[model samples]
Target: MTTVQLEHPHAQRRRTLVRGLPLAPAVVLMLVFLLGPILYCLYSAFTDMALTGSSETSFVGFENFRKIFTSDEFGRALGYTLFFTIVSAIIGQNVLGMFLALTMRAGGPVARAVVSAVVIGAWVLPEVVAGYLWLAFLGEDGPLNQILGFLHLPTQDWLFSLPILAVSLANIWRGTAFSMLVYSAALSEVPREIEEAATMDGAGTIRRLVSVTIPMVRRTIATNLMLITLQTLSVFGLIWTMTRGGPSGASTTLPLFAYQQAFQLSQLGYGTALALVLLALGGVFSLIYLRILRLEDGVR
Candidate 1:
């Protein structure tokens, strides 16, 4: 006869702990490399710390937050940041990329290949190099003004006269490739038969797109928006290298503000506080996106 003995509760718990032992090292590495710094930064946000100070730190409550909140420069930076994000990322890149993707999806292979190569080339450039390229392009006596000079058309120094617009345009040109690639993949996954059936039912291109293609790929659109928005919110190198948040802080986004505070002004605590705010904003965006993603899954 074969018999089985039930394990004791303590023994079962020990077995479960042993089973989780392999994950312990990975958990420790993550804590050390990722979560540890974030938590330390958050803790330092409440302190009065300087980049060049002694090891001693003192808590200052919400003084740093209050300082930035009431400062005109911070308010201006926040407003310009929001405007830049909305214009360059949400409107320009997303819309133009979607249009490009749709066009390429239905275009001849040669046209698609050429256009893709051009767009991807711009996107593949390093951020600093792309910033310098745009800087030169928009400078006085550069290609843009030279063309205008040839035609005797009015031309202003683009970067000086329109810093935010110039940077937004540059970002749009560089970033549209990502959104285009995303939409292209999503469009490919869409069932062609549904579109064909809609056509047979006398649906126009716009009608079919509105009622079919968009609905089918709505999840992809939401996901892409979430990713691009977060990325745009954290953009620093391109804006800094090009404008350095110059011309009276016209392009001083949150990240630039943080950098200015931490390294430029030696206000490490204030800068970390700003970083926390950015993190919180990103968290809010992520929550909203997760809800949208869940709803999309449910609908499907």
Candidate 2:
């Protein structure tokens, strides 16, 4: 018989503390860097802080929130933010990515490699670079107009006339690869035998995809939606570089509007409040996605 010794609770705790010592530096750094700034921002949102003018900061309770809620600019920015997120991330990237993944799955290895390379090449570019690229592409005298002119079609100044759409399309082009990669990974995990069984049951491609593949990858879809929605909500550089949220704030999302308030107008407190609202919006989206995941788990 082998002799076994049980460890005391104090010994176990001591060993655990020793093991956790390695993470202490990381925890301290996060508190100072991440949590510290967040706390400061939370505090600042209620104050009358400014980027310029008086150095004194005074807390004004919910005045900032009330002003923001009543402001037309904020409402417009909020609407544009929702439009951008819904059109670009939720619909465009999600749909296009799944389509690309399905197409690649049905294609030869060489075709898949070529398509992935081309798509990911666009994705890998820095946001500023992508924005500039799209700006030039959609500029009044750019190649798109040139093509339209060549086809004898009327050409409009895309950036000036349809700034939001232009930015949304640019975002879709830039961000779709992430969704494609995520969906591709999810699709790979789905069993081939199940798909074959569905096929044997006389299910067409669309039916199998609708009835089988989508259900299997539903969790991944929700996760991707949450990530992209949050990302789209915070997009500033791309829109800034492309249109500067302009042609009269047509493409000004919350992030750009917040920047305008914080830096341009010197309203730091208002900007912090806007930032908090954006954070709350992201949190709402995360919670919804989490609920979906939980429901899926319950169903399983």
Candidate 3:
């Protein structure tokens, strides 16, 4: 009986290991497929690694980073990227998302259906398709200008005159749905009993939202902000498809710069350096968000 008991425990351990065996391959695959490229890119960033031309590509140390700092184009692209991130991801996604969530919470089926249809339509469309849609909407003879013409208003070249704003709006339209879904899920999780208690204690709508709702879902807000910011920071195709980083590079973000350098100008090394900088920027943002999450956890 004692022998049987010991053998049963060993058999269970074997069964557990057998069940977990497949996970080892998955983990190894993830490290190889994902971590390998990231490690390679980080290494390449420090060296003058070219795709073509010179057979004598050597390590240039911080020269690439120095060039990034001194370049006027880099400065402008950084500023534009920051502006787009704040405007579209922070303000457009968070604020608009919250508002949509609140409205939907109070709305009837018809209103909910309408809002869902509109937001989800944008969300479900491919990025390239959304880019074309925005291009048509912002073009010289597009619906926007036509509307202005109908109203006897001055028709300006939206894409030319306001490339940043046009692109920002397009990003907001494309991304607001994700934020809306996040906030909606968070809002739903807010306990009705707690809200009722607040109402009974003379807490107004704004007070309840600010104090109770917001605090309760602070983690969700932080998570959504981090995700949207990361996403907006990496945007290339939308801006490229719309403006091609044109109108004198007014709307050029890092991704566009990288593409232009690598493929357009055939400066593969420089482009990879720019990509490394973008990765660093993303890392910094992630750390900030991580700290916030940790602080929230401590508070909780």
Candidate 4:
């Protein structure tokens, strides 16, 4: 015989406002710092802005984007960017990290600790430092060449002959630890009883991994792929320190190209347009991953 009382709509609104008051500063900061620059960049991408030689900035409509689409350099840079992202992040880091996680899961504690330490040491290195380290390692007179000489193996100048490959390998080495950590956590949450039941049903290791373990961790894998892809797409310091997108622009990705155009060539509008394109590329990747995740959820 108890009656439930309903609050008035105006009081409810006032209570909600009171609760939201504490978030005002953070909301204002985001509007000022985050939304502000994004809006400014959106505006700048359409203008004929430059660092010098142009006293007046004129609205260029799609002129800058047209220049980007028509430019050979932009095409080359876009191709390299895709190559780097796919090779280093999608395939290399993702596969190697999964392998390491599986190995550690099966190995003894000592082995797991040692491997984790080594992998995370590389991961924790600053991007510039890692780039320089790889640069020295791949240099002609570096230890890698010396080791090749000792083994009576051929060792050409790796950085010169395969600049993009070298950088991709460096990125893979530095980034794999993150994926490993992610998979390890996800794997730990997998039900041991389910795995044991699969074992009892005579499923081999590979079969169990493919059919059971992978399905369980698919969400994590997709999330990790999206994150690492975005991070790899934005990589600048590592590539800049290692190659400076040099040796005839063979390794030039969009970020390097944009920087070169904006600062060196003083084509700020074109560079901003390029930046927007890169952002759009990232958005596309994110959308694909999100779509996959939603589909997975629907299936579940």
Candidate 5:
């Protein structure tokens, strides 16, 4: 009777401890890495930290953000960042990805192979290499102009004339594959029987897509949009190597602005604050996606 009683309490203790084991590693890792660094950075952002000891350090509070808001450069960069994110990440990647997925679904093996190869090639290329390749293609005397010359059509400088467009195109080229893969996987889960039922109802391609496919894939679309928006928000290497924030501040998005301030101008604290702002932007998108994902889970 004593043994039984002891075993019951011991078993209860074991069960309680066992239930918490799964959380241990994740909690430890977050404390050591994620939460710690974020808190440190948040504190650093309000200070006048510098690369050199030339300047006196002090707490500046909201002065950094105020400086950013008042600066035309910061305003322009914010506007440009929003524009690029919407155009390249949202419209270009998401829309084109859906189109590609639809095409591949209805296309022959050969077409699918060719299209997939083209997209995967762009996806797999090194960013610097991709940037230079785009540079060569968009330069004043590049092949695009050469082709236009042969066609007896006047050609403008692609990079110089349309820096934002050039970077947007590059981003689309590099990122469309991710969205395609996502949509394709989502498309696969859509029941074939349902699709056929829609077709039997005399629904044309557009009607079927709007009424059936799109509705089914809406969750995937939202998830992909959120991911790409966050990813594109912090894109620095590709755009920097391509435009370097351009002929003026034309293509100076937040990342470029941060880089220019931190490294180029040696305003480490200001740059860190800018980085924090970018982090906040990413957090905003993440929250939206997380809510969407949760809503989808509930629906499912």
Candidate 6:
């Protein structure tokens, strides 16, 4: 017979520490790189920090936040931001991508390959490159006006007249591929027999999609919306490259507003405060999505 010897408490504690040793570098990196800047920004948001105006910094304590809410520019920026996000990412990308995915799913092999190539090709291009491409396309004498001219239709400067719409459309064209790919993968996972059964039960294609396919993939839809919404909130390069949030602030979204305030106006404190508000907006949206998803899951 053999008796087991218990390890000492100190030895066990040392072994546990050894097991977690590999994670130390990553933890330290996160603390310095990620958490550090975030904490600094939060602290600065309550102060009177600037890039140039005054070297002295003081704790203003919500003065910056108060000024931002009372400012007309912030209100306009917030409105335009919501409008662009809804029109471009939420509506345009989601609808077009879903349609493309469904169409390709029902198409022949050749059609699928060609469609995938065309759609994904846009996504592969760098953001700035895509921005320039659309910039030219929407310019005063761009392809769109050229086509209108050829058709004997009057053409005006689209970008100058509607800067926000131009950038939103450009974003939609550039970013739709992500939604398409996601929906394509989700669509493939849907059971063929389930669709067939619905069809045999005298259901139309639309009915089957609404009732069966969509319900089955509701989780993917929620996740996709949440991701796209967050991405749209932070879209800066595309809008900046296209419109520069110009035509008299017609397209100045939160990111643009924040950049203009921080860098251009040299109000780093207020800018960081606005940036925090943007972060909070994202959090609110995430909470809404999570709550909706939870409710739906409970119902299911």
RMSD vs true structure, all candidates: 3.6, 2.3, 3.4, 2.4, 3.9, 3.2
The Cα error of candidate 1 at residue 102, in Å, is: 0.7
Q: What's the CA error at residue 105 for candidate 1, in Å? A: 1.1
- Runs with alpha carbons beyond 4 Å of true place in candidate 6: 1-16
For model 5, how does the per-residue alpha-carbon lDDT over 137-192 read when each residue is reduced to its tens digit? 98899999999999999998988888998999999999999999999999999998
Give the alpha carbon lDDT tens digit for every residue of 222-292 in model 6.
Answer: 88999999999999999898888998999899999999999999999999999999998999989988988
Top candidate on lDDT is: 2
Error of 2 at 53 (Å): 5.6
TM-score of each: 0.90, 0.96, 0.91, 0.95, 0.89, 0.93
The 10-residue segment of model 1 with minimum total lDDT is 1-10
Residue 212 lDDT in model 6? Answer: 90
**Tens-digit lDDT track of model 2 for 48-156:** 9999965799999999999999999999999999999999999999999999999999999999999999899999999999999999999999999999999999999
TM-score of predicted structure 3 = 0.91
Q: Which stretches of candidate 1 lie over 4 Å from their true place?
A: 1-26, 295-300
Per-residue accuracy of model 4 over 184-233 as CA lDDT, tens digit each: 99999999899889999999999999999888999999999999999999
Per-residue lDDT tens digits of candidate 3, residues 1-300?
334454577888998799899899889998999888788777777777777776867888888889989999999999998989999989997899888987898899899999988997998999989999999998999999999999999998888998988999999999999989999999999888998899999999999888887888889989999999999999988998899998999899889988898778877778888998998999899899999999988987
Query: Could you arrange the candidates by lDDT from highest to lowest?
Result: 2, 4, 6, 1, 5, 3
Pick out the ten consecutive residues of candidate 2 with the lowest summed lDDT: 1-10
Alpha-carbon runs more than 4 Å astray in model 3:
1-20
TM-score: model 5 vs. ground truth: 0.89
For candidate 3, the per-residue lDDT at 176 reads 92
